[model samples]
Target: MNKPVLDINDFPSKTQLITLSFQHMFAMFGSTILVPQLVGLSPAIALLTSGIATIIFLFITQFKVPAYLGSSFAFITPILIATNFGENPGNAMIGAMAVGITYSLVSLVIWKAGYKWLMRLLPPIVVGPVIMVIGLALSGTAVDMAMNVNDEYSFLHFTAALVTLFAAIVFTVYFKNILSAMPILLGLIIGYIYSAIIGIIDFTAVKEAKWFAMPDFLLPGIHYEFNITSSILLAMVPIVLVTISEHIGHQLVLGKVVNRNYIKDPGLHRSIFADGLGTFVSALLGGPPKTTYGENIGVLAITRVYSVYVIFGAAVLAILFAFFGKAMALIQTIPTAVLGGISILLFGIIASSGLRMLVENKIDFGKNRNLVISSVILVIGIGGAALRFSETFAIEGMALAAIVGVILNLILPGREIVQDEDEIN
Candidate 1:
């Protein structure tokens, strides 16, 4: 079918905007679905919350920014940890949502202090390795789960998992157009089919599962268990910091795409507050906390459709699909191996996003201070080393990396300003 024509210069007409909006919704589907699937939550619930959160995001940001709120991959490890600690998936999500609100509150402080100060504390070099750590830390989980799709003790499953993972990475790096966007989903699909043909996938659940049913919507049932609360906070807070940093970078990207300085105009303070508000709303509804997703940023960058209204349109579509339980069940049938394959791309893309930050900033690698900082960050972050003070003060990986980076950037003396091609142009 021929697509309808779209006018780029003017605000998209109502019908045209509606169509384009669905494009955005489709664009976000894989990652949004990926999170809930990984966390053992109801896929329908994830979709519903994401749609609601995106709409909330649009409303809170005054529908000025072309960003959507969805499941943040950053929260996955924390969520997994919380689950391991016996936090119910829904409650864990609520805790994460609370942490997101905390993040936004912290950002308000940063924005109030002037961006120059915040930049001094979190230059590209510091942020790059911190983000790198986030990706490297999660790589193990991807490999482990991908392998477990078959025999727990068999080396063959491990080999297959590695192959699937490698395929996803290769596709993400080399594939073009639609394939690139769906590297993880495609890889998972292919891997699942291979597994099913080989008699590996246990589809008994799929057979027993109803064609349509009400999704489990677990409400927040807070328990004052210290370990659970601390564990959730420890896992959630680091990503929240990373998310805040990402928020600044993304807002800048949105401003450039929309040809307005959103960072300074409506101001980062207001935007962060809006993000917090969206997350809070998502939590109340038993969904994962919302964050400004980079995937949507890529969509905006490609389409050049800057109207916030289009995103609102997307939000509406997302919410509608959330209510369609039948469609949600169909998505669950996709094989785990295929999903693992897709994650290979998704995870690597996340890591590379960190690399791109440094490249764009022209962060110098030759300086001894720079090399030491980066090296320390990668080693500490990836190695899972933690500095323990009191029971509550101990932290690991991304959180640890972020804290060290900020401190080093501030305490260390060499501060040379390097202009980038983007900045110069």
Candidate 2:
């Protein structure tokens, strides 16, 4: 695939840029808004960070690729755990933001070291299982949330969630074009509509919500007096590991769309560091950590618009919207059941994506070593078994999965190692 011209000087006219920008914005709409809502973070902050992150990403990448950064769903489990430990939602936001900043700083070092070093240290063998565990770890939370929609524990709600989950999978797996690309969002929409028809949606919040209000921006403050330094670090490491994969994917997509391998041109290290910078900015402003949004990659793929300027325009619009009070209000007005219904799709995707990773990596589950690693990783992670060393060194779920997978990969050497060079390359 030939790379297209993407320099700002070579972009289409202003009118064309605005139109393209709107398309990019729409691409990000469902995923960006849903991340905050699903994770119990403020939608307003999410919107703002997304906008800011997009701009910063462009600046750091020198506007080389038409990409937009948005709230990362990867941090949802960590945020949820932090919240449980008595971190206020706002404080949790601060913690997550801090993590993003930390990631950004770490990314700089990784980027400078180049992609070879990254691939060497974190091979597919390690990354593949870690990803599977991430999904497994959070699976219970998905079911738990699904069952809690009615404010009462009911098998009916779980059934409803399962239905929503399956519907999303079907649509995403089989649907063509834009619909196929947005199965998670589409699933939520479909589920919400179904719930609404059943009279489960509460319109009171929507009705009472102001037309506009300033997105609540708070200074980053430390909370949760209990210091689980080790737990926080454990949570932080796995996040960084997976985020690096996400970073690579985003850059590769942009490179393919724009007709340039910016990963090799400006370098993957540069792009990762750029992503870190964007994350740092997002953290400062009290938004969920930002990453290059794959949704935007789909948008670029479909539109064939490679103009970075247009993407920058979209970023500005997001920042402007962040300042608007009414937009945030409308986001808040989204009902819990509606959100829960959407979550059924979102969290399920998180799990399914993991399965995709395993299959794509050609992980040999037939082998005893493979089976043991995969099985233990899945059970411990999904079952939410916590491993504690006093308190600071507690490991649970995704972090546990990552560690277990790495350890198993090293310890249980495959007897029949059929290396799939194609996937590995």
Candidate 3:
């Protein structure tokens, strides 16, 4: 099916602009908030960062690109591995800031060396498996949360989770229009309703919440260390590469959506630099790392509204919500079972993206180099193998897998045959 034709230059009245802006906001609401719930981060911070990041993205793209930055799924597992939620939660974000800085460096290289260099350094073969590992690693965590009721298995909790998962899947695959765009949110609604019915959701926080409260911001970059046992900063450093690959891919998709060669115009350098700065700034404020949102793009494709102003309008609304204590409190009331259901699907999709990357690039698995690299990375990553050097500094998980894949790709001789050069070109 073809998407409705949208004229990017089409100007709208204030009323239409407001309506479109709300639509944009609702479309991204589900996934944007989900990241914080899964990773033990503040939902308010997530909302606030996304809004600020989108505004920054606009500035970097010269107000020409219509992209909104939101909490990234790519960093979910890396963060989980990096921090223990209670003990060094801020450290994960500190590592995230480092990742963001790397993004800026990549932009500088692209400005001089070209994007093909990035493609070779982090190709589909390497990126594909690393992405898969990010998702697979967290699968167990999702399942455990769904089954456990306050750290013990409970049938009611399991049922609530199963129902929520089913609803999310159904909405994502069968529903159309606005409902289709908000599967995670809709699914969570169903899950929460059921969870409440079963006495799983605790609304005490919401009840105790005042009608108005200030947004208490948690700043980062205080205590930073580079180590293995307790250093989330080191664990999360490698995932930055995965996010960059995601950034490049998203820019190409955005170019297609806007019908402009953003890869050339504002250039990948500028686009990534914006995202890097967005992440660095957001992480410093204890917010999750930001990336270009796919949910917003889906909205663009659905409504055929490509106005940059509408997205800006949505960003403003997000910032407003972050300030609204009641809104953030309500988001906190969401049940663990509901979050588990969404995580299961969300994490799987992240993994599936890696597989799709390999297939789309037509990477030949028959070649010894390709097969060996992919297999080793997957086993090390998903199987949870790590190489620890010291108590404080070690490499493992997807990070280790990524480093190993890059080394193997570089050291391994002979190039696998490509079915089509134009696909890569």
Candidate 4:
């Protein structure tokens, strides 16, 4: 591993801290706000809760892991399904609380029983296809936003979307260092400019917004009634399986970047519990589910700064920015076509990430069992297969796919080949 400019425990000068923190905040800003925007939650709330969650996460891990928490893309479809396209977000919050509790319970199990069994239960074959399903499932939504204006096809809107998508792709593929890490932000900016020039953007919201004001906080039982339905819970809970797997993968890669075994020093259970707690707190206050952001990780890898203090500073900055009413308003003014254009790349990257996971792990598709698991998960999840217990309750789409994948992984008969191969290796 390359030597870090600043080690994990080393704090930079106060001036340096502010600068680095802002940089870190900027790195995570685009992706962090995108989730809530996509899911019909408050961008301000997402920023605020993410900052608080990062503080909580750092404290829980003894301030050892230099990770910044942000909104998770994995929950986009689930949040939409649970909330009835954001009309009943309170139900989604209830489901998010359940997800948090589930994480806590699973953490306790890992603390007691070790995480090896958990790994076995969710190997690459199970995880990879489920992730693919998540991205593929949202492809239609992305296309709609790119091509349509209020459900009607508009040539101008489609052109704007294409421009945004093209910019994001260029940044992602051609740039290096910080710019390369922020394809989403760059794409949005370019798209916003194009939209504004085309007279598609309405700046009325930004103009009328206060410079400083409280973000619209959607408190459960206050803004919306706490209506917990079985269908919402079912829609949301199974997603934990994929997110947990994603968390573990991030920890492993982060350990490599910082040259510290985070799983051992801070402990996987602690980090995971922090993640769950962050999501819980974020949801309790009407933000989307929080996760460790890869964008910030990219920042760390590029900058070679491993200081947790920097991460903390970034968290603080995010919190402050959340109260900036004009900034929040500006984010809201972003055109749907622009978002759709960016989503084209973002969603495709998600699906590609899943396939990359399979390739990286060298999953043997030549084997019948392996092929069966992947095929079943992809079809069930992307095909919108559901196991409905009642009108009000059903495990459908990605959730159903994940549950079925795990079961199939366990009961399938080709375990001996892997075990024998393991022994040989």
Q: Which structure among the candidates has the greatest lDDT?
A: 4
Clash pairs (backbone) in predicted model 2? 3-259, 4-259, 104-276, 111-269, 137-381, 211-326, 212-325, 212-326, 213-325, 213-326
- Comparing 1 and 3 by lDDT, which wins? 3
Position 370, candidate 1: lDDT: 87
lDDT of 1 by residue, 211-231 (tens): 656666766555333234565
lDDT of 4 at 153: 97
TM-score of each: 0.83, 0.84, 0.93, 0.97
lDDT against true structure, model 3: 0.82
lDDT of 2 by residue, 259-278 (tens): 67766666666677667777
What overall lDDT goes with each candidate model?
A: 0.69, 0.66, 0.82, 0.90
What digit string (tens of lDDT, one per residue) describes model 3 on residues 325-396? 777888888878778888888888888989999999888988988899999999999888878878776787
List ranges where model 4 is wrong by over 4 Å.
416-425
Among these predictions, the greatest TM-score belongs to 4
Off by over 4 Å in 1: 1-18, 85-91, 150-182, 185-212, 222-228, 389-393, 416-425
Candidate 1 positional error at 112, Å: 3.9
lDDT of 3 at 418: 35
